[model samples]
Target: MNDGGFSALVVLDDLAAPRFSPGAAELLALMDSVADACPLDSAALHAQASAELGLGDFGPRDYEERLEVLLAAYRDAPRLSRAGRVNLHAQFLQLLKNRLLFTDLLRREPGIAGIELAPPVVIAGLPRTGTTHLLQLLAATGRFRTLPYWEGLEPFPLPGEAGVVPEPRRERTQAAVALMNDAMPHFARMHEMADADHVHEEIALLASDFSTMYFETLTEVPAWQEYYAGHDQAPHYRYLRLHLQALQHLRPGPAGAGRWLLKSPQHLEQLPVLAETFPGATVVITHRDPVHVVTSMATMVAYTDRMFSDPTDPAGTGRRWAARIERMLDALQRDRSALPPDRAVDLPFADLMADQLGAVERILAMAGERFDAAARSGAEAYLAGHAAGHLGRVDYRPELVGLDPDDLRRRFASYERRFLPSEEPLPVDN
Candidate 1:
């Protein structure tokens, strides 16, 4: 545990160390008890826990131990609060429901196969650099099969006739959508999220192991970020491939429809490993001014933290994001040579935003696929329906997000020269 580098801030009070609310503590205890009784393999347990926590494949290792400590502290603490208790109860209920659903699915379909995700055309980039909008645009082409939010949540039951009807699964997605609106009504404006037809990252499948970067943003815990950044995520993709096969097995695809279109910033760090695993895979890497990326991502992280935790600090969040991006970029620079030329393509954020249709054409062209007139029309329709101003509104200045603009420019000078020399430098307020 000492070597694990679980920061004192994660476990202490705001001024002292990281402090857990009583509800968070109680939820931890309930999970620990389940883990103790299940006696399952680590990966299986992780998968099960991920389903339960709504954490979406991002359950931490030593999850049991962490739970026990929180539970014990909650029980012993003299100042246990009502809000803490209520929060814990809600979390526990959700976890229980997830575990039951996951277990039942495994029992019903023994030896389930994973999705045969064809070589994906992945979009990787720094946050707030037009990656999301690009993915959504690409998904509209109909040539790519994106794992929609609904299917990702209910991967056990293949979406088919059931998908056509207003089923419980559909209801769940609607409920989630409603909750999102309640939590962050403004999010949809910055980046739209829907159940049925959007391209999403496969990171949640990796999150089952708590090794993904999703958790760091959800909770402003520096220790968690440090531990997550250094971990090898190559194995998670293997697991993801298996799950995809399993889900796809249930719903056979129309012939010639391309495999999943995945997107995630975390992929930058694991690019080499990803290439090795899926040699045939085509990758689309997005580039932006590192300073702009850092600042915008910090704003995103701060907003996300507010949804799940207390005492979100914009400065602290910015610092952690800067460090993580630096590491990811460094890894990308080191591993660039490992990727074959034809398999990789880099697109600048400014260029993509300026000419999204052209960008999509180039990306598909690189993959040796031509979008038919119908596909092109579909892409246009999607873009028209889900316009830029519809979701996930973000307006952030570098200074507001605690970044030193001049320093960032110098740090990412080489990257700018190589990938974005022609684009205007992101506006920075002194």
Candidate 2:
């Protein structure tokens, strides 16, 4: 069931992993030589990052719990090329570094803990269902505040940006982006990132705590997934509140910025947690056909997995994700039924693409914000300036990934009937 390149990658992985991702023959040999080296000395990594950042506090060592899980995955991931191992190791260190930096800043400035947050307007639903597009439009309304991509990547300010000198953090973020774009240009085509792009999701912030699907999607880490399957995200949600407040305090936007606009497909899986953390926050849920959603997600995850892994199993990967998505849909249905009517609104993928401005107007009304002519025009201008689905045509066949369209539809039948096209009921008549 795997696609064209799957077997070739697997066959070459153990001996020539660099052939797939690294692209350099010598690096492949080096990877073989270093494959047996120790991975991610957590204490040493933490100490080094702390010294580098000149910060000692790591808030609570609660995140330490995830370190062992990551180490386990690093050890078990098969045919992990030197490049893949190196990248994964670097990411963990960076996450640790971010935790130290953010915690130190928050600890030094106690007032950051008290900054009140506008009840967020969160976008949730299936991947490829216009959540990012909707979030960007909502942010363009200028009525809401969101983090810049760089801020999302590096949430804390450098030591002295209030001075006249240039901030080194910006330069660092830019350089990193450039390197990534150069190294993996195709990834940008699918999920482009830049120095100042709007916050796509809180994934990076969640990664700092290692509580999201950040690692699972990037690699075939079934053990971590199994562990996370039973874990509670309440602590992560609490940390998210603190994290948002820190971003707001460091980069204060307009006096009356409407609210914090957030989006992530992960939200659908944990809607109750979000509701509990930010009570009274407005939620927007997007719906698309399950067949398309499942297949597209598998392909995207496979791309990322291959980048950070080797000998990727397309069939197994797709099967695991398909099952996960089915569970998410089931959870979504239960949560939506339990939610208060005024708390959330459903937006169908068809409606958003067919008339984005109309969808935005409906969203604005749901958020209790005015959608005046200017606001309508702003949303229109946002769409006019930016092409939708800039990833071009994606043709991921469900069968190609071992997923049956009928099975996906059957699994999501109840959800589709309630929220998908022809059944979606928007309160607004716009």
Error of 2 at 273 (Å): 1.3
- Candidate 1 structure quality by residue, lDDT tens digits, 182-252: 55444454456755445567765554333566645554445545455555667666656666665566665
Cα displacement (Å) at residue 50, model 2: 1.9
Question: On a 0 to 100 scale, what is the lDDT of residue 112 in model 1?
Answer: 61
TM-scores of the candidates in the order shown: 0.74, 0.86
Score each candidate by Cα lDDT: 0.60, 0.71
Clashes of each: 31, 0
Runs in model 1 lying further than 4 Å from the true structure = 1-116, 157-164, 194-197, 390-393, 425-430
Residue 70 displacement in candidate 1 (angstroms) = 12
Instruction: Write down the RMSD of all candidates, one decimal each.
Output: 9.5, 5.4
TM-score of 1: 0.74
